[model samples]
Target: MKYLLVREDDEGEDELWGRCANVEGLFVDPVPPPREVLTFRGCTPAGPLREAVSRPGESTALLGNGYVEASDDTQVDWWELVDAVVLAHHPSRSDPSLVDVVVGAGVKGAGGGGFRRSGPSRFELFVGNNVSAGQSLRVDGLLAPRQDPAKIPMELIGCEPTGRLLSALRRPRKREGDWAELWALDRTGQVMAHPAVGLGIDGTRPSVLGGTLIDITLTDGGDDRPAPAARPVWEAWYQGVPTVPNQWAPYSSQGRSAWLRLALHARRPRRPDRSGGVHHLDGRFVTDVPGLHCAMSEALAGPGGYFGWGWDAFRDCLCGGFGLTPPFTLIWHDADIARQAPADAVSACEGLLSYAEEIVQVLEDVGVTVVLA
Candidate 1:
């Protein structure tokens, strides 16, 4: 089995220790030097140094093995020498031998250790067992190969209630470009419909809603640039009293006529007695201003009733002339003809729209509610 040799202190280098015969020392020196010594690393036996003591000839041979010293001066043992060599080769963190060293050194878990500021961008740790949440650990000297944050198996530690443990291990959220690329590849829009997207709306732009986030930067033309800020626009919708359907074809004469008929009836006042006295005019056949005038004059005509086609005349009639009373209704069908006037009458069409809006506003002011589709 492979072993990751780790250093006991920062004073020396780490190395890989294994059982092989080509190493410098392990067997006793012969009367005549052999071609090579049966050794592992700089020591002999090519195996766990502890096992050499149990074996008969191995113990005697290893005692004379130059790598191991029984003297108190060096304080070097066969096992310690093997550990140094194994760690020098940089074994994987998951190696059992490496794990033993780290755990034996008092590190509670894989990432649990105490940390201290070493520099502006770097920190040092005194890794040992019993590290608490929010505390950093140092495993630099214990593990064969140094572990990078990205490659570390952070899930080995259970999640803490305070979440600091996981936060310390987790990678930062992906940037806007990365998110957008992911979304584009999603094909299905389900990712856009996620609830998190809505929650993030407060921090996002309107253009990016239902899509991915975008990073935006603003400058104030200064050397000391400040962080960018954005103000969001909000919109609202109100459901007023229900009347006619809200669908209308503004480009078609017939559709406009239908709309006018519905609007007029929707705005008609209800009598206390609820009798059928409301005036309604079906002007679907009326194409131009003259035809419109003729139709209105005939429908509104009563005792001494006289209507006109001009804007001024129409306004006057609506104000109470033409023998029409308040609380009355005029269902003007096909009123859209004026709105869809010929190319030569574009100005007239615009004027018609303006007049209609004004007229609707005025009528609504007098308790009339027009439902224009």
Candidate 2:
């Protein structure tokens, strides 16, 4: 309910659009960005397909879809499912293409099942090196990751009739390129998440509830609501804005994960790295993977600040602009908490290493001096 929509002024400062009294589609279910899913339907297996799938790291290269093969152009909409893992390949169902013949994971149903495509297509799956199978493939009409949302309906209350909102609606063509950040706040005036959105011409109407109703386009519509288990953490944050360290230590693992996610979502643009400072990290609460990330994020940036949620994002943060630059000393207080907490394995070239070791290795690799205090 506490939402603030703000766009940049000519002077490059965020100009608030007053308070948003009522908003729809702002706190809706979070739809993750769509990934490329290789869906093969109805096609029978060939050349020891089951045996090839049983083997580890069995990759399958889909040459081209029916859409590509029917066309005259040389460009094929090709996709390869690397380390391809078969989710379901049962040929015993009544309808051959009703709801079966799932393929690959991660991008499409990691645990439950693989992604399914609608319609029909003729494609060949080259599995391993010797085995090959014919597949009826079709790419679904799901929105791609880079595609913008069609619309995000919102209503602003207490806005001036001759204000920027009215002005933008009057001449949408001239201001069509404008974008704004919609910042949602908690009950205690703490920011929840700020998603960037663009203005639109259509569906801009005066609300019957004495406000302006506008349909904005989402640049990125991240999930606004916290998890049920993590609601207490948000409530705790509402009790007091996290200014010091260890504020996230008292929450459960699930709550901590949600907290880290919220921190990641609420990340603002960072100033240029001054490039020198000893970032002291309290490791007493590094009981889980999420806790480790939460501590690291809060340590590097501030309370509710984010460095990274995972190793890749961590490396990205170290590149610059995430609070402290590398080459500075990271005096990790109570480092043994992480080292002796648990044996979490991380993928490495030689073999698997504990997550703690991986963290230290990543830090050292990035030119940050790590001190185990």
Candidate 3:
């Protein structure tokens, strides 16, 4: 038996129906024919065609706008007609041990009339834990006989990952705001369409991945790049006295200044009623970009009054060897103002946040507690 899959166009042309009727094969046309040619309306021939295609009976030739013609000796299998790649894997909502694999590709609808004239489509399938991103596979199994052919469910039979698929996954690329193109490739290395994938970190590096520093810079401004500077010397206090209890604290002598007050609230000391050790850092600062930089530099100034104003400088100070001591808490007041800064300034602020996250991760790795509020 043979099957023909014809897609409907916007103009409502039904020429393919005539071709299917004249040919001595089973026809699976989704678009309704003219009323004079066929009285059936909202009726589709998907059920019979799906049964004919999947049952282990006789050889078949699957013909369609997107389908390739099967050879004489080759048995027609639904899986052989479609190609897909694993986009991501998550624990199945129904079962934990089994993973819910998200696969995507450009597949023609099988029987249902719900096929869209789009390139690549995404669907989820349940698979074993062995399945992972970058793995390519073929679709096999039966489609449910329904009006919406697009809802056709199929099983993914694993196949070796193609070199192109692996290469694309290892260095995924986003084109024209689409990440789907990274995985929607045919066996012959042809890309179907650009699709989106949530695979990369959201900010410029240095990034904190699993508590380790990723030494990659993502900002175009080069703010996180290492710069040549004098060897950092550590200092604990200034003029043999802790700086005033203002926002600038003991680092005020270093030319570090903030527009807000920095007050250290003492808690009950370890010994009953003496005094509580300073427990947490809490404060706010100007939300503007330039103000933010100045406030941060002043708040984190080191012993010699040295405070770097940019991400590179801040990172150096956080890694010790500079003047600022570890186990400190920083309370950033009015931090939300940065969001309204100019576009370029907003980008710089994001880079600063990235650097801060990385620094916090590194400090935590060494058991040094640093809190940013």
Candidate 4:
């Protein structure tokens, strides 16, 4: 089985580790990430990486067998090895072979990006409302009267949760025209996601999936042990985590950050419950998002012809509810779901649809039309 598959748009694979990997990092695999899933693998293990084919300087990721080579190592020399074995990261400003750079692009399953034509979406983004809903659906040659959407990449900037490391990762080396980070290549010889951390612990290698993880820890840096939030160790798994923070939680501006994304997601039930892992969450996940019924593009086409009843069927939500994720795009061992771990986050448009409904219903039940997005 091919462990790594390139996601439709992302330069990296849609990793299945958890919200960070599945949603944020984009680990490619057979299945898509689920809404309320059980994360199986924590960090990628080594053993399998060293056995794979490799390139000149690129090595493995600190996480596991997934390969980790910088996709844009176009310098004239062998700097990748120096950076990989020394600094541990090499950032790529633009994702390679990007065909569609769009936002607010999509058609169905609740709401997220508008589904239409594709464009150069450099991710000038907002979690939900920094701009308008269906924010200017920019695509192949569809320019508006007063706007140049072409500047979306430069004009609207979204923050990656890892902004703190950008400088160090993108730094220029003493060698002119050389990148600050190392470039990794896969068995098929492709540039993979930059691991960012864990280079040179003991001669790292690359994985067929793109990169392998080195067993290293940088969280303990800066004299005193940094807080848990700064570390690379996966967040601790526990039962009863809330679907949203308890109102007073501090939020990071980089909404896509793993920790922040999990907050808005559904809470997974603990062990010993009858629901059988997350299957018990069936009925609870669905709810209505404000203006959900009104939010569709006038051109929705009505579920292929059901009309009033067809539109109404969406309101019923027979499938998974809003916020609740579906079966994972990738599952680690067929058996042993526990090893897969509980899902605490979501990103799929389908899963987000479940959430959109849930939010709408929550407001409607209170007799308050809180929002229409």
State which candidate has the highest lDDT.
2
Candidate 2: which stretches are off by over 4 Å? 8-18, 21-25, 32-102, 106-162, 167-179, 185-193, 198-241, 250-280, 319-323, 326-351, 369-373
Ranking by lDDT: 2, 3, 1, 4
Compared to the true structure, candidate 4 yields what TM-score?
A: 0.19
The digit string of per-residue lDDT tens for model 1 on 193-310 reads 1000110111212222223322221111111111111000000001211222222221233333322322222232432322124444444544444334444554555211234444
| C-alpha lDDT score of every prediction, in listed order | 0.27, 0.57, 0.28, 0.21
Query: Each candidate's TM vs. the true structure?
Result: 0.22, 0.51, 0.22, 0.19
- Over 126-172, each residue of candidate 4 has an lDDT whose tens digit, in order, gives 12211111111122222212221110000001212133223323444
Candidate 2: C-alpha lDDT:
0.57
| Top TM-score hit | 2
Which should have the higher lDDT, number 1 or number 4?
Answer: 1
Candidate 4 least-lDDT 10 residues: 148-157
User: In candidate 2, where is summed lDDT lowest over 10 consecutive residues?
Assistant: 63-72
Candidate 3 vs 4: which has more lDDT: 3
Q: Give candidate 1 regions above 4 Å deviation.
A: 1-276, 302-305, 343-373
